[model samples]
Target: MQFDLAVIGGGVNGAGIARDAAGRGARVLLLEAGDLAQGTSSASTKLVHGGLRYLEHYEFALVRESLTEREALWAIAPHIIHPLRFVLPHVKGLRPRWLLRLGLFLYDHIGGRKHLPATRSINLHRHPAGAPLKGEFGPAFEYSDGWVDDARLVVLNALDAVAHGAEVHPRTPLTAARRVDGGWELETPHGRFTAAALVNAAGPAVLKVDGLLGEAPEYGMRLVRGSHIVVRKLFDHPYAYFFQLADGRIFFAIPYERDFTLIGTTDRDHTVGEPIVASEEEIAYLCEGASNYFKTPITPADVVWTYSGVRPLVDDGSGKPESATRGYRLDLSDKDAGAPLLSVYGGKITTYRHLAEEAVDLMAARLPALTGKAWTRSRPLPGGDFPLDGLEPLKATLTARYPFLDAGTVDRIARAYGTRAERWLNGAEGWQALGKSFGAGLTAAEVDFLRQEEWAASAEDILWRRTKLGLRLSAAEQKALADYLGG
Candidate 1:
């Protein structure tokens, strides 16, 4: 059977495309070479910000859309996504105060923002957010944005796409695709797909897809590698910190998932063949950039985790990372304009929904028979339908219901899985009833649910993708889980 749309790559843009298409009543199939979010989506700076600094670059449209979505995403997924205030401490001899103020003023007005609080100025010497900052930096400005579990966000979108009748295949590679009479014929490890339309959201490999379809005009994607690092907790406040470097670039240091702090995002021009590892140069760059602003300095030894990804940007002929545009571009091509293939380029997590709406809306003009309208605007994603202002009540209820389960253990599962966490906890009379412990929150039941429902096929899928338990698990524990999952 032919699908209305076949989306390649299972990262944010592709998953968002599948979910939006499926919701819009398009028969959709999404394919991923590896697990969903195993690439750039999982390796983000993890801020759903409006890109406050982008204002300086004069990207108004990109800033406006992302700022608007910041609140929209928060309202829909309060459990997995929440509002975070960032402190941008002002330093002497850097971008002057007037310029920074102008940037923030525009940043505040750019997006049709509502839920999040607007920017405010605070004295660094007196405020708590300033305690960690050096004496040279004085008062700072604070603003609100959203923070999210970037990996799990992809999973939730994929889950919603599946719930909406889209076929989501992970570990399924799209080896080849060929244009047919009216659509395209594509092959995967599992089966073949015939689709009326194709969405080449292959992300970093989008250029490769262009070559697959016989290189069309303006067919180029710039691969810029960005890396992130996580270290032992630096401060107590939940507010995230954005520091301006000497090079006019900014890096983030956020109070991460409770116990640790997450910092990073270095933009360096790189090739795909290069190992996506944090080099000594990058580690020191991030460490020094962050430490220069903080009272307590950190070193490579303090880093607990690190990851990298390549952003697939449309080649705009600009070489500098700061000047490179963040706005996305769509090149819909075909022999005839009516029935064409859509190739997506340069999208971020913040603007994904709007991007999907625009992509499918354009496709609908081609096929007027396509059913359904934009429903994702108000609809909740999978388990995100839980009713509450927060997940604390649900966490409390889970703790009470599963008295036999440890408080920390129940909280972790409940928050991560929400109403569906029961699939992991159901009728377990005691800790022993939950089955063998796999260390951390790696229970036998959770692992089973991951494989059965979330398309987890390996230890990396379970440990890194499904859960951040890898952050807490010792090497021995990780190895044990790997060995067991391998068998």
Candidate 2:
């Protein structure tokens, strides 16, 4: 296939770029080596906020850009993204109270605060979030951020790209690419194609792709692996946590799926090709960290599930992985050096849309066919047309229409598909009409919709990426789902 732009990854950056380019009238092709978001994009801390700790490092621009984009993203994809309050308790020994207050003040003011509430001082002993914490934890600060269904965000961006005439092919790896007379020639497992421009958004594998293109390395990468653990709910309240360890590292413990609490993120330096599983040491570190604050002790045995992903951070010579900058760099090939090739390095999920917009803008300068201006900033992704505060109403509507679905199922569907839930639920009058049940509210009809529309082909793609039902589905149920897909 020949196109105006070809994006070479299906993670959030590539998907967002494809969506933006295609929306602006460019013919776009998106190729992914694995299922969409099967890598770093899905394995995020899953919070959309300004990195408050970054203030100490003086990453003011990055934090400001991320903070500015936080609510903008929520406005467009309110279904998968919503406001989340974080409780940052002040420990007497670490990060003094006045310093915390100053940081919070800057965090509230610098980002063009509009709708989300401002930070407030609270007594941990008096607050509902304090009930599960140790008695020693007294004063705390409640601040605003947002939570995201990380994997689903990638899928939705891909879907929106397809809606705008972009061809998205998951599981198709790029084999080769060479600059040609007018543009570039590309090879993949499926076939060969040509394009006016090429984009390398391969996350951690970006350096490998650059080597394939025979371009000298322009930047060093620090592959920092961040791991998270899911356990039974730690607290009954809706507030999440931002805990600072004495070792100068921080992690979060948040309310996860209705039945679980999600805690994470250990920042350890990772070598390329290393297994991206949470190490026993890392898991213990997190458990010990959580136990320091929570009244109940946490251990590896309490961990129901663990996930890890590497952040392809630009090597800025930081002393620790946690101190590495979350900022991004865009390297566009020289104009006289043949066809334009853009390589993306070091970005976070919270600023993907901004990164994509900037990427497409760079490409537009090289390829005139990319004439359309930036439109993703305000436009909603697929199934995200409702207002920012409209989730409860949307859920109520789904419950009223599909009375047979339990509250858990209704909330899941409404959040996963938003206004698009009806696309699968339209004609089913009852559970029987929705086809066979595969446990945990996953019906055959819903599976079919995912397969037909969202490029889902396997059980892992369905249970894990398309939805997080893997957390709840059993071995037998997952096998049944696989068997059903195979048959």
Candidate 3:
């Protein structure tokens, strides 16, 4: 089929770009090598905040754009996106009070924040947020951010794109793309899709596509591996904790799901030629970081689950891992160095909407018939037509309708799927009607909805993407799920 644009990779970037393009009246097709968001897009830190730390590196533009997007995304997917308060405890030697205070000040005012609250100082010795912390630490500060269901955000964007005239296919890997006529003919495991414009949003595998066409960019990509650990419940507070290590880098201990605390993220240079796994050293380091701050220490035994992802950052010659630019760059390449092949590099999930708008804008030049300016900025993402503040009413009405669903399950599904929960329910009677139960509470009906509506092709795709049950289910349960899916 001919398309105005063909996007490779079903990750958030590809999905977002395709959605924007299709909404702007461009015929678009998005192909994923595996299930949607099975890659790095599913395994993010899950924060939609302006990189509060990026301000430390003087990344004003990236921080500004990302912060502005935080409110937009929360507005669009309020159920899945919500405001999170982070507690930044003051350490004696790591960072001075003035520096942290200044950072928080810029974090609030730097980005034109409207919906989120401003930062406030907290007495660690007195405030409950710091009761779990070591006594020696001085007062701390609290700031606002937005947390997202990182993977489902990608799926919802793809769903929106599909609703807006985009062909979204999963488990359909790209094979090759050779320039044909005035456009590009792309071959995938599924079939051939011809397009005048091609986009490489393959995350780590971006250069792989470039190599196939001998049109790779001049700069190489750095694959930085990051890992996170989910431990048994740590605290009862709703606020997330951010601690700076003695080594100057920072790590977070956030209240995750209901019965666990999520801690993570190490930035080590890596080269993953195959499926990546978390290094033992990385796991140990995370535990040690956790031990250093919390009054109650946790060991490796406390960690029930672990996950890792490779961040595909454009190598901007920054020697330090933290120095790499978080901003994305669009490179247009072609067979004869003239055709339009847009390859995206180094972007965060929070800023995807603007990036998609920009991608569509560039592709519009290739097809002048596609002219309507950007509409996605204002369009509700599928069920997001209702104001985010109004979700409580929807939840009240849903619970009143189906008392069988536990508060957790209903709230989670409502937040994850938003107003579309009705379609998933499809007049089901109760929990049993929702289908067989997975250990962490996801049902077969929810799983089927993932497969039919969200492009989930594998158990991992459903468990990890549409939901984070992978972190909550036991090994036996996971195995049963794998077997149930015919794995």
My TM-score estimates for the predictions, one after another, are 0.96, 0.99, 0.96
Residues 96-150 of candidate 3 have per-residue lDDT tens digits of 8999999888889978898788999988888888788888876899899988888
| Candidate 3's TM-score | 0.96
Candidate 3 residue-wise lDDT at 349: 87
lDDT of 3: 0.83
* Candidates, ranked, TM-score: 2, 3, 1
Residue 147 lDDT (model 1): 87
For candidate 2, the C-alpha RMSD (Å) to the true structure equals 0.8
The residue pairs that clash in candidate 3, if any, are none
**How far is each candidate from the true structure, as Cα RMSD in Å?**
1.8, 0.8, 1.7
Name the candidate that leads on TM-score.
2
C-alpha lDDT (0 to 100) for residue 452 of candidate 1: 86
- Point out the higher-scoring one by lDDT: 2 or 3: 2
lDDT (10s digit) by residue, model 2, range 13-37: 9999999999988999999999999
The better-scoring model by TM-score among 2 and 3 is: 2
* Strongest candidate by lDDT: 2
